[model samples]
Target: MRNNVQPSNLSPDPRADLMVALSTDQREHWQHAYGAHPHMYGDQPSAPALHAVEVFRAAGARDVLELGAGQGRDSLYFAQRGFTVQATDFSDVGLEQLRDRAAAEGLNTLRTMVVDVRDPLPQADASVDAVFAHMLLCMALSTNEIHALVSEIRRVLRPGGTFIYTVRHTGDPHYGVGIAHRDDIFEHDGFAAHFFYRYLVVELAEGWHLRDIRAFEEGELPRRLWRVTQSLTG
Candidate 1:
């Protein structure tokens, strides 16, 4: 594991008002957003997700856990590729859509669960071979909450298991465009996001081996993000 990246002191916004929890209204915002379209994020797996499948296959992993698996595009993709996937998200409507699609495809290897990533994940410790999340950590979460979630992920992953995630980086064009909740957090049109810097990524992977951090841009928004992969040190 390389430790060449220096840590930075960029902290969360200190404003009390800005440190609010991800409210039901925010959940409703996502629910309504997905409900508005037949498929909000589209049917294709994200670039990072496809990359994760390649990495997991290379590592010989089979049992995969997906966080914030909205509409289950990636989860279904994993299932179709013969991985047993536990797909989780906070949105019932989204999970229902995923379930319907998975059922229609006869993806018996895929399971859906309604879960809030801010809370302790409902999974057994050291059970899963790998965990995957795409842009889930960049949601409306405090720095402390993110740390807790990372700890939870570390606990649930088996020894030497891998965790792959993607997040909008500070380099993204939309980083500071909206109402400032904090230094790195912004709320735009009722959608809140916390952007990640490379230093923050290093900080989050403190207890793990930071395998790689690759940059990519995609979508009509042309979102700029980092695909971060980490592994548990056995």
Candidate 2:
């Protein structure tokens, strides 16, 4: 969220255009990354997470379900803000690190789980107050999987629940640069990301009250992203 991070039109990586297949499963790549670089994304909550706290608070949300919550930076922040938090990720290594931090801090309001967004959420219908997922929907999931995940989010959320998410978009420098997967996904280095088009966001919000889509940038790559906020109608 640093203002002086890479600019919007930063030079693209020279190797980004390589068409080599991303042979390794993304799960393995993430596991190895977390093993090699514990707390890699650092401890500070993301910009989107900071924004979500205010939105959730004003919406009177008391419990939070955070998907793809790597290392629990945002989840810990939510718990510290006095909201009950369920933090989940596909990587157990990352969640373990998160759990240790939560335990050391005595953050009893925070809990961690290993979850793959492609599957149905474990929560019962109309159970959670709000959901947050920073840069999760843009992961290697196909369009169908992403749609299904949104449906699952809807199922788990209580009426009038807010969901805030961010995604790298077609305007990103790496969008058309790497190995092509189905849909708009492309692999750069070992990570595969599904770059969103604006239309896809609209389609995903069809059943929800689409509240906002704010453009933002993140990381040294200065990934162009959309921070979307939508809410379920009571």
Candidate 3:
């Protein structure tokens, strides 16, 4: 297990006023969640992230762009392994915590930024060697937004670059349990989540080469997830 450190008091949580949908308000919700606790999630690198490191190393990738990098666990892991990492999230508090952790660890290769995946990424075309997002795609985004995000990811990646991400699958026990917001979206605990089906994966892989798909579970909730890996065509 990784050691947990106390986060700085960047801001207080305002979860009481936050909404559970895909809007600017959702950003505050995440910020509140991260601020309310010393650590919202574990410090250990997620399984898909660990797998991505091996894949990227084998592909001779030295730079990685991580979307929705909540607490920078995977970013720190990659930085320790000598990969330059750009870690982004919408939560200001989360990014601040990540910056603190990176500085303390002397991980100069890891940089944090406030970014919303629903918007165009702040990156140059073909600038990154790999793109990673663990459970970012399953957030409260519409189908169109997911497509746009994926397109942005593909645009920023170098030719033959890898894109690795994980998302909650429809098979998850939590699917359709909470208040239904849309077709596959559900709201619970002041957050909205859009679950994905296998067919939706196919739809998302329109331009990229779908390399692999694997199912796994994690956390006390045993959240079912689909780990997807795709490659940009040369």
The number of the candidate with the highest TM-score is 1
**Model 2 Cα lDDT, one tens digit per residue, 27-77:** 789989998998899989899999999999999999999999988899999
Ranked candidates (TM-score, high to low): 1, 2, 3
Candidate 3, position 178, lDDT = 79
Models sorted by lDDT, best on top: 2, 1, 3
Off by over 4 Å in 3: 1-21
Please give, for residues 92-185, the per-residue lDDT of candidate 1 as tens digits: 9899999999999998999999998877999999999999999999988766778889999999999989999988987788888887875377
Error of 2 at 132 (Å): 0.2
For every candidate, C-alpha RMSD to the true structure in Å: 3.6, 7.8, 9.8
C-alpha lDDT (0 to 100) for residue 190 of candidate 3: 74
lDDT score, residue 95, model 1? 92
- The lDDT for every candidate, in the order shown, is 0.86, 0.88, 0.84
What is the TM-score of each predicted model, taking all chains together? 0.91, 0.89, 0.89
